[model samples]
Target: MIGEMKAQQEEIELLLSAFDRLVEIPDEERVVFRTLIERKTIPAQSHFVLIGEPTADIGFCLSGLFRLYYTTPDGIEYNKNFCGKNEFIAAYSSLLMKEPAYFSIQALMDSELLVVPFRNFETLFDRHACWEKLGRKIAEGMFISKERRERELLMLSAEERYRLFLGRYQHLENRIPQYQIAAYLGITPVALSRIRRRLT
Candidate 1:
């Protein structure tokens, strides 16, 4: 709900390339555009954004972990996302519609982020075609990953899910705890242990 982040005014060109090759931005235009970036950092177990909260900023992680989750009537948590370095983190649906969000983002580890607000995003996109391309590519990438996860969930067994989890996020499995992995996989910790034992 807060648009407190101010563009660093120095890192835009470098950040832009994180989304795409950015060979299209003319040198003169790029020098001008570089003045519009800002950095944001969110701490562990903290809310980067909450359910029903306004979505204003689009953020890219410089480091650390965050998850998107929703609570059920019985107060159980279901994590729908896991993201870290170089990843873009935002409630895309809410950001696109300029509405309140449905999912809550909580940092699993201390995080440093780079962000551009909706106002700046709109102004930049309208004025610079290069920024628009970067935005479009980020959205497309997120869509592809979401679809892939949906297929994996529908087709894979629980044990297979655990194996795939390891294969996909090798860095995360070793860093986070087993219980968190179980929660992400929709399994009990005991079952996860059994799966691990079988693998060994």
Candidate 2:
């Protein structure tokens, strides 16, 4: 039990360090943040959030990978984004609108996450200016990522997008399935294969 507690403390410190990189989190605030966190392990292929469910927590990936995707009525799934270690994942739209999530966040690998209720963060925002700034910065980053993704989908060729994907997720290529990569690039696996052959 002591060992487990020590491990959890280390994880909280790592999360606080990551947050410190974005904005200074004072020691007192860090303590409060620590109190809000719950360590969770999601098995590979399991979901952190499911479509049509209200999302209540935001997760910071401690290890492993996750994919955020939307499924069509006919049962086709499209990858919207991937979250890797040291990154945040959440059903942002659902949290913002107080509605059920339109998509799901699934673990691509057995994953460890530092989870916190979104309401807890909101409470912190009211307590400290630093928390408010952190929230704003995080939102801004999410918006920029969304806009860039939209632009890539609208203006770039599949081949061009594939190149960009290779650059952005070079570390993840071997870790993820080709079919999912193709999904993210808005192409089929066959198309991705052709593109890869052409590149080589």
Candidate 3:
């Protein structure tokens, strides 16, 4: 374990703690696991990995945000998920399979990350039963998240969706464009404008 790296991330300790729970490892074990990790940072708008590209690594954010999105035939990008600071962000299926990714991961903010290749990760994770729990957690989370998105799209009114969005991401209302919110909520931008007007 690299003690120096741990010392350097004093500001993002909470992030590490959250990951520790997901991976079901103690801080000490995590540090040992992290000793072999590679560190990197990228600016916003940079693609971390692109669709159909081979992915061998998994990454976790220490700070900043990430967007995992895919483009349609018409070249429209619908965000699949936003990986926030401290969260794990990886094309897990591809990385684990050593195959091409289905979606692209991009930095939405200036980002810092810890990366580990599939081989190294497999070595550590396969050795610990607890590490397998992380994979289950990720899978289960993806399922629940899909359900929530479906419910919001099919059930919520445009205004209600806008309100829910503001409740969860108050500042993001400004950081994110109204059009993007409209796309996420499956509404027209004009409808979003009306919702915003009603709120104000």
- Model 3, position 74, has a per-residue lDDT of 85
> Which lDDT tens digits does candidate 1 get at residues 100-187?
9888898999998877776777777777787788777778888998898788778889889888888888789878778778877877
Q: Write the candidate numbers in order of decreasing lDDT.
A: 2, 1, 3
Off by over 4 Å in 3: 1-15, 23-28
Model 2 C-alpha lDDT per residue in residues 82-167, reported as the tens digit of each score: 99999989998789788999999999999999999998889999888999998887888899999999999999999999899989
What is each predicted model's overall lDDT from 0 to 1? 0.78, 0.92, 0.74
Which of the numbered candidates is closest to the native, going by highest TM-score?
A: 2
Residue 199 in model 2: shift from native, Å? 0.9
**Span of ten consecutive residues with least summed lDDT in model 2:** 13-22
How many clashing pairs per prediction, in order?
A: 4, 0, 0
